[model samples]
Target: MFSKDVVRYHHGHDHDHDHCHEHTHTRGAEVENKDEKTLKILLLHWVNHNETHEEGFREWVEKAREIGKEETASHIEKAIEYMQKANEMLIEAKKHM
Candidate 1:
């Protein structure tokens, strides 16, 4: 049994936090602009890929720091830049779609 206040609290907000909920319910656009659905799917996939790459890069940087490896730190920095580029590309693609 749930309290009334609890139910009210859950339903009271009209904030943009509902975007996630809306996103789940909404279907992709039907019109084709370079195959919009496919492009959106690929962009989303690349976003995840870039995120994982960034995470791994961060982990590698942390491990290098722990080992006091300055040379490896520089290499990790370069890798981070590349990951950031990939992330930015994915973000731009999503915006266009």
Candidate 2:
């Protein structure tokens, strides 16, 4: 499963996690769209956030390859591609705004 899914599952049902601060993104559209300015800010934020994950996933891909997990590495590569596509779409949306 994806990291976000694991995060949501852990945080949504279990309250024993170490983190305390609220994640505003989890609230979705209602919380994100206060105005166009706020939405633009969130778009930039999400793009940066996804880039961080993509970097980490790339690192894990190398680690997986080292451990002879080529299949896992390939899957992570695919995930990186998806993240890039998402970022492109986000950038395009920002352009239109």
Candidate 3:
């Protein structure tokens, strides 16, 4: 039988566990990392934001093509590709959310 379950067995090994923190400091800036609940919301927001930008980028690509600006279209496509990478990252980050 294949049991897909998460059973927590604490054998006094507390040093090898993953947990999310509420805040983080970077470059002397105190940033609110937020807890799991907030993270889920933020992840969903980023997913929407990235998707919107991706669509806008594609539209720009089409506009560039319409004007026979092959170079601009190519650059916009590259930007779309980069936006896709960011989308992938945001999707993966949902694991923590």
Which of the predicted structures, 1 or 3, would earn the higher TM-score when compared with the native? 3
Candidate 2 lDDT, 1-97, residue by residue in tens:
1122223343233221123234455566645444565667668877987787788899999999999999999999999999999999999999988
Candidate-wise lDDT, in order = 0.64, 0.73, 0.67
Tens-place lDDT digits, model 1, residues 28-75: 553343356557766776677567667877888889889999789789
- The residue pairs in collision within model 3 are none
Worst 10-residue lDDT window, candidate 1: 14-23
Residue 76 displacement in candidate 1 (angstroms):
1.2
Give lDDT tens digits, candidate 3, residues 5-71.
Answer: 3335453322222334444556332344344555776577667766776887888889989999999
For model 1 the TM-score comes to 0.56
Distance from true location, Cα of 81 in model 1, Å: 2.0
Candidate 2 vs candidate 3: the lDDT winner is 2
Displacement of residue 84 (Cα, Å) in model 2 is 0.1
Go through the candidates in order and give the clash count of each: 0, 0, 0
Q: Could you arrange the candidates by TM-score from highest to lowest? A: 2, 3, 1
